[model samples]
Target: MASTDTNDIYWRAYFKAIKLQAGGGATEPGMGKEYFYIASNANRSIAASRFIPMATTNEYLYQEADNLMDPNAPLYVPGAGNTSYVQALYTYLRHVKRPRDTLTPEEEKAEKALTQKLKDAQATYRSERKSAMADWKEEKDFENLSFGAWAFKNARTFYAAWEALNTADGALQDFLASVYGADAQKYRSDMKKISGVANDILAPVPGLSMTCSNIPVLDVAEGIEKAKKGDRGPPVGEPVGYERPAYSLDPQYRDTMDRWAVEYDSTPSTGNAKVTWEQGSKTSWKEFGFENIEAGGGVTLFGFLRIGGHGGSHTEYENVKIDEKNSTVDIELKWKKLQFFNVYPGTWNIPQIRETYPEVVDLDEAQKLLIRPTQFLCASGLSITCKLGGQAKEEADRLYKKQVEAGGSAGVRWGLFGFDAGGGYKKEDGTQTSTSSYDTQKGELTISPTPTFGNCTLLGVRGQAVSI
Candidate 1:
């Protein structure tokens, strides 16, 4: 029966906390604007004094407990008599025994006098609250930052009740303290228990990834985002978009390029003809077949048309399936023009071949062009076909998956894995290889690999690292 009653009190407190946290429901007016909507709000000052700090403390408790449990327990809410406890607490925090910047002589005297009375009442309340919670040592040990914060909040209400008593010219401070100060302690005690409950809920369970250490990394950003957007929603990375630049064609080059395209396309159908450049009536064309026009037989180009494959040109084409009807039967040919000037037999064919491969017009042989590391490696390793193997290969795949999952902008993971250490592989001999690793924090991996026999030594070293 007692447990049932405590559960009811807890749920009431939990609902109130939720309403305040979520900014919803019709609150009983007087607890700030949440309750301001209500007309007959009698306990306005008391409710505000009580619930405000309780709300804050409750939030901290929630954060503290969030990692421990899946379904966190509820806090305790003070009833009508306990509501007076609220006023008493506020009074103590806001008035008597409260911190003051500047106190007049009379005010200082009054404050001192009130402080004594407040302490006495607090002692009595603490005693009674311990009895109620059935846990004395634990509640008593809660001091300094945690206990001080609790006292400061409850004291706000205590001060209020203290003021109301004195103003009404009742044995007000003393009488009010005597009446509800114990309840104030009970409220404090209950709050402490609720905080403990939250802590317990958030405490890490055996073998579970849910720990105080890891949860913040996973949930803090999401929680804050939800709070900001007015919903407990997950976080999405930075919103991104691309604006297409306006496209405009140069009207001047249109005529010459088109006439050249038609003339080149009509002539003897070279090796292969493509309208390489198309703009209005103007177009650019390319045909590959013979080498030299004047000498004949060798591939030569006149206004984008080439004839012959002998001299410096080589024929390479892939027959790609054009459509379903002709699948393997009829294939469209796709090929690239290859001009190796270094292998050409004579210098007389060089000038015409240079025109065919215009890249021969480099003024500075010493100029180093900036190339992507991946592209450079791929090009340099033409024999081995050194393609980007792991993360780089997955970049486009990961991006497409994220786009499809998020559909708009919600599904992106924009950071690297925490455990990634940079890696490199080196092979001095054709059959022997070694590997190196690096860490961001520790700085470097001191890995020295020695060959057991130096022949056919294949080593695969793998380990996981964590980052803070």
Candidate 2:
């Protein structure tokens, strides 16, 4: 949200709160944990201050789901004490429940009036916010140039929760079997039964195929995106998005470099301090005064999920930079959940087979893709691997069955096995740890990291390397 318009959806939800803190509104502003809604409301500022950051995953919300019927958690009631603040921050989610129909006409009118109040109050702060924010479209780390982003906060939690629901209930197993398939049950046994990760929010996921995962790659990707967008762009790379405010070393010359201030790495625990530029002024970015950007979250994925192959599910996901967590599926899993019949040249003209194989033998394309890498090496002779775990044993047994079913090393010669996932190893003192950042103090003046924004900074800035 910008100083230009706090009346937008996200900001509008929190405008009154932010404005009250910024001291534009009538009520006395809050600082740090002191921030709270009007005294007449819940008045539980302390609890809210702690809970807001964990708004998405707070166990209370999960318990409140009542079988995960609604995509949006039905728990948050607006203007109440505990839950309303979340609705305020993520404003689009008005406090809604299943029995709860849409807001009454009186409630709608009240909301509209409140919105007008918020707009009126925010109008006074708009110009100031505009001054504080730089033209950030050209910023490199931004996932999409558009300001709105819907990142998967804690997607693993959705699968984990589903795993839990399935495991805990026999009725659910019957439902899954009846609706989805029997083999669907096998997919999740590997999901939740693990001890450590059962409660771990940042659990490492299964590495299937040529997937690249780092610190829960899905979550890291979103954090990196937000960090890039939140910070300024580099000195070099990409043409200026909007026209420069002041320029003309020459009319013929167009500056391609970012003329705006370069942003600092705000990965610090205090959130983005923006120490270089103080907050509470038109000249600088407001201090992001929290630990978590509150950036990630878990979503509810209950009920019958469509299954794949022997029984699982498949979908092609796109545009994740702007989609919610529930939407990011099989992104890294290159598995072909698709089905296709084998086409034999000799049997191609068979009318019943439609120029395909005499028999419509469906094959997993991903299975072929999987076999290609190890094909030559394994065919060379024999191969052996060593690992120790119940999970590994389970996988070995499963692979043995599949390999046997495929005709005992003749049909599928090569084999591949992923290492252990869901790092649930017990810690020494029952505590997980962090090593912390290397902490580089040098401020990035240019776009490039090496020479500090590279050639653009050396030239003091240029427009379009191609143009020059």
Point to the candidate with the largest lDDT. Answer: 1
lDDT of 1: 0.22
Across residues 1-468, which tens digit of lDDT does each residue of candidate 1 receive?
111222122222222322222232322211211110100000101100110122222232222211111001111111211111112223222322212234567755764666566556555544543443233124543322232233335444433433433333222233323333334453333333222221122121232111111101122223333343445343223111111111111222222222222232233312221111111012111110001211331211111110111112332211111122222111011111101100001111111211222232213322111100000000000000111223332332344344435433222111110001112333232112222222223322222221211111111001111000
Q: Rate the local accuracy (lDDT) of all candidates.
A: 0.22, 0.20
Please provide TM-scores, in order, for all candidate models, with all chains considered together: 0.16, 0.15
Give a tens-digit lDDT track for model 2, residues 263-354. 22321112110111012213111222111111222212111111011212422111101111222111101110111111111110111211
| Candidate 2 lDDT score relative to the true structure | 0.20
lDDT score, residue 321, model 1? 12
